[model samples]
Target: MANIRFHPNHDLLSHYACGELESASSIMISAHLDLCPHCRQKLASIEAEQASELEKSEPAALSPSLNAMMMEIMAQDCVDIPVLDEAPASQLALEDKAYPLPSILQRHNDKIGPWSRLPGNIKRAQVDVSGDSQMNFIYMDSDSALPEHTHQGQEITLVLAGEFYDENGTYQPGDFIVQTEKHKHLPRTRDGQDCLCLTLLNAPLHFTSGLATLLNPFSQLFFRR
Candidate 1:
């Protein structure tokens, strides 16, 4: 069981209704919605809205050379590529835990694994990496400040450290937070054990400053998750 953090100013459940949730957001909402059926129906109503929107999108018209060119491109496809030691099907099934980010991340932040030193007081190690999603564990030194940044989608930050606060509130060990597009915060950890967190995000931080925006193009190619 996880402690619930509610926001009075923001109706976070509204994000669920807007279909703006990432994987982490979906899981959090699922558990909470299960406990509250009114929100569950709200989710259903949201789904219906998405369906209607999808039905109304204009389809793109393909160029006259599209089919023939696609056939030519496919005909030249190279074969005989083999991968070694793929992850087991069980691991890919995502049945391991309901709190996958928290469980996997907290266990490994105690010691380093692969992800290395990044700027600021943050050190990250990627644990679960697949095609569309990435799971990283972060450790922030006390008195460290991670610069203000926005995210490509949603992120689940599970505090495994002493305590950290942004414009929001302090997060301590066992505190799980879902950060969506609507939420942008600068975090800091001070006066205690190093703040460690499990951050599962769909994409990398999109720096939101004028100077940062100029550097965004490079970041997408290299710093992308």
Candidate 2:
């Protein structure tokens, strides 16, 4: 059993299985599922429940126009759409090291931007997903710390490698943490332990500490394209 301390709630998992979650949130959930067997089993259960419910529901009658359009489309030449292989021989690189990405993100490997250094001993690479939200791969070097901050809207962070600690507790790989304006904390790694995380932010972070407050103006740089 994987010791995953954090996980997406049942509602979020249901939404993810049903394809109802936003793109950014869906990516986070997918990454977490890659590392969490518990969540994988939970998701399978949810999917089975959904299938049972769908089986019990009565089918609705299609409109005459919709039925005619569907018939016309079906009568036309059957075109075989080529299916692209989802597995790619690619890796997410940090410095000289390369890490295998989650299966869901493999297709978007090209959309990841080059890494840029941050004020702290952190490096960030943005993922270009079609949505209002922002997704990033945040790499924290050993003994590094992010400025104390809170989210303006919502922030989801999933540990990809190593471990990090905030005032709340320590987070290992597969931990799915959600934060909003109501939560504030500083994330850091100890000596000899580096950390990498996939983060999705709906809004810019609000730095609240003394010197870190000065970084509020530059917070947009973290999320902006």
Candidate 3:
């Protein structure tokens, strides 16, 4: 992902490395780690540091009886390790179009719901990642746009395929974007480009400007499946 312009911050990555994030958020970061070499390297460094600290910590001495018990267990015949069955690659299909999912998402294939229509030219497939937040696969058709909106809480979007642009800049595959209440922008693709994104929203989006404002009342559609 050479074109990736956005990424999870160090604090978020640190939390992910520490296994301190919620399951849904952890999956999001794990998928991003698959796409991002830089973040992967950073996470590796963080893990190494944590491992070093653990190694440096003093361990209590074991009693002779406990040590003898451990030795007796180790002396027993070892059982064979079971080989895991390899699963076929997973793909997300919409009509005739299909997109390969990241490894982390592939593991959750059963959790993905069917695609449903949304306002504008957008379509959404809810991902049943259990948490207080909502996760979805948001598909934007070519030349289509979502109305300008700001977040009620926090919103995170990771580009899975194609490209999209906002008032700020264009986002390519592997780009990790975060939005707060202070930001308001329309997200859309160019004439020949459609986009598939994985989005995690902690709260409903507040549609801004014109007729889109009326949509604010129904914003729960984005929050709920």
- Model 1 lDDT per residue over 66-132, tens place: 8567557757969898889633322111123222333222333343246577666677776544345
As a TM-score, model 1 comes out at: 0.51
Among all candidates shown, the one with the greatest lDDT: 3
lDDT of 2 by residue, 29-130 (tens): 988888899999999999999998975662346678886886687679978999976666468898877887878888779899999988689999999988
lDDT score of residue 135 within candidate 1: 62
Whose TM-score is greatest here?
3
Supply the TM-score for candidate 3: 0.88
Q: How many backbone collisions does model 2 have?
A: 0
Candidate 2 least-lDDT 10 residues: 54-63
List the candidate numbers ranked by TM-score, top first: 3, 2, 1
State the local distance difference test value for candidate 1: 0.58
Estimate the TM-score of every prediction.
Answer: 0.51, 0.86, 0.88
Off by over 4 Å in 3: 60-85
